[model samples]
Every structure is written in structure tokens, then in C-alpha cells.
Target: MVASSTSSRSIAVLNTAPTQPSAVETFIGNLLELVIHSIEGVRGRLVGGSPQR
Candidate 1:
């Protein structure tokens, strides 16, 4: 089966499936990733670079 997931940088396959995500999924995923990364970056900056447990 083909499975797709979104990471902080780009879309990734969960397994060795050759299938790709649709254009809409890709576009929305990119926007979601950007928002996630932005939140993480802002949190890091405010938290003084300390790694969370």
C-alpha cells in the first residue's frame, strides 16, 4: 500500500511505495509544514534553545 506523510521540510513516504501525493495534498502539506516549523522556531527562540525532554 502507498502511504504519505508530511515532515518539517517536505512530503515523505512512510514505506517503499512508489506512489506520490496529489497536488492539493502537496500544497496543503507544504503550508502546514511551514506553519509547524514557524511555531517550533518561535518557541525555540523564546525558550532559549533548550531541548525539551
Candidate 2:
């Protein structure tokens, strides 16, 4: 019974560990996107005219 309980706990931990990283990755990805967008906006304002073909 002790072994069974320990295995189940380990399994639960393994399942939760992967999800935490996924959430962290998702948060980082969103933060990066926001930074990129803000930089682009600033660049557009500084440049004034649009790019030529």
C-alpha cells in the first residue's frame, strides 16, 4: 500500500511539473510579443514616412 501511494504521488507530481513550465512559457511568449509590438510602434513614429518599395 505504501508503494502504491508513493507511485501515485510521483505520477501526480510529474503531471503537474509539465503544466507549470507550459504556463511559464506561455507567459514569457506573451510578454515578448508585447515588447515587440511596442518597439514597432515607436519605430513607426520615429521614421515618419512609410518604407518605399
Candidate 3:
């Protein structure tokens, strides 16, 4: 299916796309990322490998 710019509904959907990730969602995502990064860093150190932070 194709979205036609002539339709107001399609335009609204496009606008909402950027706001889909709200503040709380973004925060949780960032927190999860940091946790994953820390885990990887520790694993790297244990394996005698360097992790580029």
C-alpha cells in the first residue's frame, strides 16, 4: 500500500512517526543500552579484549 500526500490522514500518520518513541520509551531504551554496553565491557575485560566505549 502507498501513502498519498494528498490525504490528511496520511499526513497525520507521518507526523506521528517521529513522536512514536515518547520520552519514557526513549529513556528506557537508553537505560537498556547502557546496561548492555556495561555487560559487554565487563565480558571484554574478562576475556582480555578491549571494548571501545
Candidate 4:
């Protein structure tokens, strides 16, 4: 019974460990996208032309 409980707890931990990194990765991805867009907007205004392809 003890072994069974221990294994179950480990399994739960393993399952939850992946979720934190995924959330962090998602947040970083969104932040990078926002930064890229802001940079593009600034570049567009400076060039006074449409954004580059």
C-alpha cells in the first residue's frame, strides 16, 4: 500500500511539472510577439512607408 501511494504521488508530480513550463513558455511567446509588433510599428513610422515583408 505504501509503495502504491508513493508511485501515485510521483505520477501526480510528473504530470504537474510539465504544466508550469508550458505556462511560462506561453507567456514568453506572447511577450516576444508584443515586442516584435512594437518594434515593427516604430520601424514603420520611422521609414514613413508600409512595413517590410
Among these predictions, the greatest TM-score belongs to: 4
Backbone clash pairs for candidate 4 read none
Model 1's C-alpha root-mean-square deviation from the true structure amounts to 10.1
What TM-score does prediction 4 earn?
A: 0.59
lDDT score at residue 22, model 4, on the 0-100 scale: 62
Question: Best candidate per lDDT, number?
Answer: 4
Q: Which pairs of residues have clashing backbones in candidate 3? A: none
| Candidate 2 lDDT by residue in tens digits, 1-53 | 47998778757767879667567668889999888887777777789855332
**Candidate 4 residue-wise lDDT, 1-53, digit = tens:** 46998778757766879667567668889999889988998899898988754
Off by over 4 Å in 1: 1-21, 50-53
Give per-residue CA lDDT, model 3, range 6-48, as digits (tens). 4666466558796654664678899999999999999999999
Model 3 lowest lDDT segment of ten: 1-10
TM-score of each: 0.52, 0.58, 0.57, 0.59
Q: Between prediction 2 and prediction 3, which has the larger TM-score? A: 2
Worst lDDT window (10 residues) for model 2? Answer: 44-53
Judged by whole-model lDDT over C-alpha atoms, candidate 2 comes out at: 0.74
